[model samples]
Target chain A: MSTLISLIVSGCATGAIYALVAIGFTLLWQTSQTINFAQGEFVMLPAFFMLAGMNMGMPFWLAILVGTAISVAILGAAFKRALVDPMLRHGALPLAIATMALSIMMKEGVKEFYGAEAQPFPSLIPAIDLHFLGATISTQSLGLLAVGVAAVLALQYLLNSTSVGRQMQATAQNPNVARILGIPVERMVMYSFIINAILVSVASVLVTPLYLAKFSSGETLGLAAFIAAIVGGFNQVRGAILGGILLGITDNLAATYISTQYRSAVPLALLIAVILFRPQGLLGTAEERTV
Target chain B: MSITRKVSRLAVLTLAAGFMAAPVLAQPIHLEDVAELSGGGATVGTNFKNGADLAIAEINAKGGILGHKIEITHADSQSNPGVARALVQKALDNNPYVLLGPGYSGSVKVTESLAAKAGIANIMGGEAAELTQTGNEYVFRTSFGQQSTMPKVARYIAEEIKAKTVAVVWVNNDFGKGGRDVINAEFAKRGIKVVADLSTEAGQVDFAADVLKVKNAAPDAVFVYLNEDESARALKELKRQGVTVPLIGETTLTGQKVIDLAGGAAEGALAHVGLTTDAPIPAVQEFRKNFAAKYNYVPDHNGIKGYLAIYVIKAVTEKMGKVDPANFAKTLHGMTIRAKDEPGILMDVTYDEHGDIDRQGFLVEVKDGKQVVKTILPKMVP
Candidate 1:
């Protein structure tokens, strides 16, 4: 019982990290039909930026702030204006291709400049373990869980209650009609990109202590979240959140109960099953072609 | 033809033959190094390159190898086996006398046969046990194979710690998997039970699930065998989980790079190292100082492997009394190079017919961010 509880607790913590990144994926897919393939690399870069800032005598939180600011200015606003706008003009496929190229560039560029070593980052929470309900949980895990849940709730509120979000939803549903209704469709996409950046930045800071800041770390980190978003539902935020948690727990349980060698295989098996049986995902509704 | 033109053509022909025949008159030795200078294996490759370059600088200053200044052409493998094979082909195209490189075992497995076919010696830093098992005579290792290293570690766990149950955490790659298999066999032979065996991905970030599983197992000790960065993350996660079991591992687990990344978590971890900068020998201390001075970072086991590859070429050539590429592998087989004779070799090393190496090693414990030697295991032969 204790072992099961420990696995669930740790797995959920891992899932929360993945969910934070999946939100960005779901948001972009909904707003502009854009899939940022560089999502994982984006998370990795800002952590290094924060490390550079800390090296230059800034506190950890201040370094993170500076890093987040730079990401907003460049990866968010400037990226949309320069590359995303031009690429999306052709279609989402072109934007996806562009983001894939951007991922490689970010990986290689960081490897060239920052050196290919894992730099240790300061942990956000203390390294204290507390026992609760017959299970051992680290303070760091609890801290990260709280932050991730809080961020998700805040994002959910923003999308459900705010006028900007309503307009964004209007643009997502029918960009032509939203523009006709004076919704500023371009600005809605811009807001989606900015929000994606902020979410990844938060995710980056939360996970860097465990992953450390390495150039190749993003490859797996991004891939895991992408799977979560797809398995949960590409079009719905709640589906993505559930998908992340489900994959996380299943992964741990598989490792513990099944063969360790086949632990990764089990989640992949689930992914294939979902794709085959329910392409619309667990919580998603089947959509009809309107053409 | 005019008599003057005929005589000039004759003179030019004779001069060209002389230039080809008297190649020994040239002051430089042509060598090629293809290594993983960027990507996943970048840290290993960079350290190896720096170590090789340092040895070259020192040797050139001391009147060169057999009176020929060593000149090495370095290429990047990018950590991909295919890229490494392509680079090896390119290096062989130059018809280099020796090939050095590709610290990655997968790269070495693909590239070593090329050098063997070309009759050029390849000295690499790959630690996978199966790398040299394919009967590739031209490939030589600067570190011990898992086959050689695991038995010693197994003996330690059974006798020293006397642990009946053990847990093994390994990266699911050629290097880690190879080591894990060897250690498992060793443990089985020694009648030790493997309670939990956790396999991880190469660049996996979260170790919470892995750690929790290990904690649930509640083994007497844990064996970690992963790449440098992943090892650090596992250590950090293990510390955070407050697992009080002693950690034991091979080279990468307690490496200087891992220590730097794991911060305080690496302390008290024990590892069996084939080559470490922390050896008590004066020559090793000097290597540590020179490497730190040159690269401004403490050298890891891979660096020592790289430095020795260059020194081995010199030692073998000098002993053979000629720079003979065709006879290089044959000469190295069943040959022993003594540290007393050539201090650059660092330790007395012998190479068998299969290209495997035997030399002194150390069991060290990480103390205060340093690998403090616990005991020096004597060379396998003497």
Candidate 2:
């Protein structure tokens, strides 16, 4: 029972990061109808940037902020010029190919700069355990859970209450129709890309303390998030969070009860089951397309 | 064509021919080295390269191996088995007489089989027990097998530290699993209770969950059996959480990265190490001084293992007075070299039919962020 609870707490902490990355995926897919395969690389880039900043003696929080800003700016420009502009002029495949090439180049570039060694990231929170019920949880885990919840709530507010949020929704629903109604559809999509990059970057910074900063971490975490998005229902934000948490819980439970060796198999199994049974996902509405 | 143009063409052809023929005149004996030179295992491979280079330089300076200057071609396998096989094939096409190796057990297993089929002598630096059991005859190792070291490490922890209840945490790979099994068997023989046994992936960074589990179990000491990065992360996490049990385990703990990452947390950690460049042996000291002069860094066990492996090969070859592959194997199995005056090249060198080394490990403890050799065990002549 203690093991179960501990796993759940830790899983939720990791799941929160996954959910954030998945939301980035959903945002891009919703607006542009194209997935940024380089989304993971975008997430990873900020972590390394923050690490580089910290190595240069900058404060952790300052480093993270700078890293996030840099990644957002680079990702925004790249998406606009390299992906969006080309796709608008040509077609979707060119953007897809460009993103794929970007992903490879990003991975190699980071590896070359970082020298393929896992560097320890300074912890934001003190590493101490708080006993709850029978399970002991670390401050980092608690911090992760808080971050995940905060990101979700903040994103919900941004999408519903804010002007940009309404603009993004309008653009995502029907760019042609929204533009006909005088909405800046192209600007909204660009804003969505920038927002997605920031969200992923924030998630990367939060998780770096736990996993340490490494070049390939973004890809590994991004893969998990991608699965969570599909399992939850691609474009549903609430479902993405729910799916990520559920998958994290399933992974931990499988590792404890079934086999530690096959812990990674949990997300795939859940994805298949979700796809088979609830094609629309737990939180996704029936009107939403099952893509 | 004009006579002047023809004469100019002949002059250019003659210069190009001379440049091409210069390489053929020397015909350097190219020896291929495949090891993990990057990622988590880079230190191991880098050390091996240092030692191999030192030996190659020494051989060339003294007169060359078999009247041909020694040249080494290196490839990084990154501790991947598939990559190791590809590297071996790449090296074989270059027609090297000897292949130095794939540093990890998994890579060695793949490379050794390939080398055996190709009728090439492989000097492996990895200490996996199964590598010795291959019975391939052509595969030679200067390092003691994991089977030999595992029991010794377990005994050291149980008896020296007086830790009766222990937890075992290891990577879910062949090397970790193998070491864990041996340690478990050894612990059981001594009637010690294993409080918890856990496994994590090789490249995993976050070990807080695993560390929490081990802490909750409340073992006296934690036997961490993973690679350098993971082990260091585990140690740091455990320290941060105030879990202060002594860490005891494999040679991976001796890596500089582990020390750098763990900092003060690694001070009391006890680990197994074959020989450092600072060993009391005179030859080892000489090799150390020379290596430091050449590379500007102290050599680790990986470098020592690689250097000693070639030294063993050279000694055996000298004894047989021939470079025949079969003779080389026979001499290796029957050979014993004493670092007698130096006392540290290896406590003593001997080998069995399984290619198991007769060398023993030194129990080293981290003192002031450096490995201080605590006790040395004499070679167990099997």
Give the proportion of true interface contacts each model preserves, from 0 to 1: 0.63, 0.22
Q: How high is the lDDT of residue B212 in model 1?
A: 82
Name model 2 segments beyond 4 Å from true: A53-66, A83-101, A286-291, B1-25, B37-69, B206-209, B212-220, B240-244, B263-267, B275-300, B303-331, B337-348
iRMS per model in Å: 1.9, 3.0
Q: Compared with the true structure, what per-residue lDDT tens digits does model 2 show for residues B1-382?
A: 8999999999999999999976444556667999887655666777787788888788789776555677888898866788888999899787776789778887887778888877777888777777878678878786777788888888887788888899999888777787888889999998888998888887665555677678778998888888877878788777755688788877778555577667677888888876665456667678878888997666667888878766676666556665655456666776676666223344567777767777756777888888777887777753
User: Which candidate number would show the highest lDDT if scored against the true structure?
Assistant: 1
- For residues A48-148, write the lDDT of model 1, one tens digit per residue: 88998999999998999999998887778987898888898797788989999999999989988888767787887886889878777877777777876
- Candidate 2 on A51-163: residue-level lDDT in tens? 88888999989998888888878887566766677675565567767787888788778877875556667777776778887666777777767776677688778888998
Worst 10 residues of 2 chain A by lDDT: A282-291
Give model 1's TM-score for chain A to 2 decimal places.
Answer: 0.95
> Which candidate achieves the best TM-score against the true structure?
1
